[model samples]
Target: MSVHETPRRPLRVSFEFFPPKTEAMEETLWSSVEKLAPLRPDFVSVTYGAGGSTRERTHRTVARLVSETDLPVAAHLTTVDATRAEVDDVLEEYWQAGVRHIVALRGDPPGGLGEAYAPHPGGYANAAELTAGAKARHDFEVTVGCYPEKHPESPHFEADIEMLKRKVDAGASRAITQFFYDNDVYERYLERVRAAGIDIPIVPGIMPVTNYKSLMRMAGLCGASIPRRVARLFENLDGDPATRQLVAATVAADQCLDLAERGVGEFHFYTLNRAEMAYALCHMLGVRPT
Candidate 1:
């Protein structure tokens, strides 16, 4: 009999969630949380809406997660709409609410991505400043956003790398990259970041494509290129929701396996308020429920 060996340990996982707007959505979000909690992710994050529109709801969710669950919560904060002091105050509030980690970002403009990003008059101009301010006010474990395929606003890849270095220098303990479909894109970006001497962990972010049309719209806004192959996978699946989900899980599972073979062990998943897909991928990566 031949024995197949298991990986050394399950990849460290984290989940990202957006504050729910409706009662039904909130129920779904908590249900998903309950389902995945047994896996014991490194941390879970709740996203603040653009321009801090969901600031209160985000706070409520993070606070509740801390109080009601055993999970550590990372609050997503941005420096795009408010003044420096205003944003800093919010960071302080998160600390008071028992949130010890934060995902700092130079948020999308109120007009959304693709539009010009004009910093508010008194705001920290970018993510780096937000990271520094958060660290200064408290000993928060700060995670900043990164883009593997280059931020759309950046003029070139080199410029994007320089910006990432700046964030690292400004006390970002780690970076969670924007999700991409191609493993090669992430590998190349990681190489470039390492070559630039930025030593912080750059955790890959993965988004399972449950809804092809919606995913494409989001990818377009975020500048993630959807390959023709990906499109073909969902082309004839409009009438087959179950198969589409299975395919989505398979694709993401393959992406993680490729990363793991290269020694990547940390993963951040954009859960979209759902658990089955992320949970299934993590299970395949050797994450067992505790």
Candidate 2:
């Protein structure tokens, strides 16, 4: 690392948003969308609700993006609760609405994660199957979920790699990992993926923690470990939203820079219906609107 070395080009970014449940929230959500649209993300995704509750809203948001914005939109589809035919119908609807990209997922069970995962008798069995269905229904650019620390239900790393391979074989063009604080976790998992001969892009997912308590709870439920230092950074900021946001942006910026130094170029942000922190972090990473 020499002082004469030039900085690398800004990395590509994407954002994930959930459909709003109320008028106020809808306004907030669209405001966030408008704020981040100028950054020219590779694509933006709208998440389908648990048990597919927001199916219509998700479709509407993605449809609006297609009709109203210049940014490409990826609709998140899951096969956790619906029959294969039903899920395929949703995929068909998205295609008709002009969605060319999909984030295929098995989705959380109706009972939620850590509970027993019983597949719908007639639905796609897993993300791999969902990816295959999406490809069969339409020529979509599909992205599947990856768990760098191993999905909680997976017996071991080899099993995780095998699952990823299955999805790739089923026509997934890329993988977006669950958010993690440790860059080493992503780097090591990537090495394993490459060693296994899976070469598709694996974009790291980043969740900027504006609320420490909420972040910790989500991380615990999802099997994403929070480093002690990360906890320490927010230990006493419980009452200070302003300072918490500043620290959140700084931490995410550092995480992205570390990944960039290691040659990783793509990031997927879980915006959680807010854009300020993600926008700030992108600014720090040298990303500007095209």
C-alpha RMSD values across all candidates: 4.0, 3.1
Q: Report the alpha-carbon TM-score of model 1 versus the true structure.
A: 0.95
Candidate 2 — which pairs collide? none
lDDT of each: 0.88, 0.88
Give candidate 1 regions above 4 Å deviation.
1-8
> What does candidate 1's lDDT look like per residue over 189-230, in tens digits?
888888898888888899888889888887888889888877
Candidate 2, residues 111-228: lDDT per residue as tens digits? 7776878889988999999999999989999999999889988899999999999999999999999999999888888888988988888899998887889878878777899999
Estimate the lDDT of model 2.
0.88
* Model 2 misplacement above 4 A: 1-8
Give the Å shift of residue 56 in candidate 2.
Answer: 1.1
